[model samples]
Target: MACGPEGDFARSCVPSITTSGHRVTLLTDDGVRIEAAHTPRIPGPEGPYAPSRAPFPAPSADLAVVLAHGFSGSLERPALRRTAAALSQHADVITFSFRGHGGSGGRSTVGDREIHDLTAAVRWARSLGHRTIATVGFSMGGSVVLRQAALHGRRAAVAGPGEHGERTDAWPDAVVAVSAPARWYYRGTAPMRRLHWVVTRPTGRLVSRLGLRTRIHPEEWAAIPLSPTEAVPLIAPTPLLLVHGDRDPYFPVDHPRMLWAAADPATAELWLEPGFGHAENAAGPELLDRIGRWIARRARRTD
Candidate 1:
């Protein structure tokens, strides 16, 4: 059977595999309700191996990856669904709609509060009994993953118990950020200029609501949060992979380079693709397969 709209997987292309997937709604710490889908990995014969663009240490089994979509994008986007389908070859996949997009509730704070959205998804993945969990995000979601890793990784490392006396640690074991920006309030490119207008201007906000079905928050960020580059250093020990396209019209090569420079080289790997453009839109089957293999290898590692 075909996958459901919310990514409920009844059957898959691999004939010998039988795994179940379902739609779930996650409540963020801040109380926003986010829409998500969970698809367990289908165990079967392996497909062609795609070598990693960059070399890294091998890894754990039964890995789970949480996919965060970009601004104005939803879990229903074809590109994201294709990515989820491709990734399911190697691991269980969970895709979620950030607030202000798709079926999720609340207005977009652009990238600021989205960290909570990722946190909720990561927590859900952990609750599923997957010992190894990774988060893969694109564009705005990429920024969210970096910040989430930085913020929650530290908390999870030292946190004791919650208000309900349950452990509050919800950080992922690994993180992959694609086409993420190095800093906030960037308007270097025409697309970003337009995006700024969409998020900050009244008319543009209306257009976003009507044309894009995205509801952006009207107020400016009360205070500047930790930039993606700055957040990189805090994600140490946890493996990190930064992927960017040289031809990207959004943030350009400097963004990823800055992020790589800020990250600890021993624990981070950066891949600068020549022809790729942006996030999921630029992630083709070959790229996705390569990423899947890389993540699978990382998940298998004990250290």
Candidate 2:
């Protein structure tokens, strides 16, 4: 049930401060500039999208998590920082941008191509010596993480099942999706429809024209390998967790509710907050504690 060697590289942990001890750089892969940064707990948060600290010396800090931001958002969100701060005890964490969002390359694939970006980042995380990785995603980032799990499986094999075609030994032992939209295509959506129109037409067009690929992927990306909703089944038996607020208006809890319902009973979980929204953990401690505990439980399971 554990991830393979690839998973071992990703499960390493080191305490990191978002502000300092980190420097931003870009790694090139297949002609793409993946924005990357590294920080130690000594360096604290300075600017937006700066990376979090890895557990120093790796594999020594106990555990680690990788955090991906929501659409139109960066790692600077207060909810994220607060949660990261609280979860620091579990492992060293990393926060990253998707392709064009924040400080990365390419344009958003609307959860289409960014999954590639997430996969590549995980590869990088695994290489750093992580053992049990817990992917915590918000909104679209949540979708990206889920898609990565469903499609490519986990980069690390020591953590969980990595049965996807790649057959990596390492994989994420635990997965958390917060306020994530389960079925985007099934939409008779008002907000997403309106939001889609806004981004795809004027905003998307404007940014696309400017050569700025933010949330929407460029037209050149004609074929995508998978859809976020399609990858739901593959996450089973991997300790999948879903958290959403009742008041979440972005993509109704009904979506995540359905996701939890559809997920494999043996490997999935859902937590619906009474008055949370798109991301209530942004300002709340209780949610952070819940997330931390889930991550800790998964890491200890391997121990």
The per-model lDDT (C-alpha) reads 0.80, 0.62
Model 2's TM-score against the true structure:
0.76
TM-score computed on alpha carbons, candidate 1:
0.85
Whole-structure CA lDDT of model 2 = 0.62
Give per-model CA RMSD: 7.9, 7.1
Each prediction's TM-score versus the true structure: 0.85, 0.76
Q: What lDDT does candidate 2 reach at residue 84?
A: 63
Residue-level lDDT of model 2, residues 70-93, one tens digit each, is 776555546666666666645666
Best model number under lDDT:
1
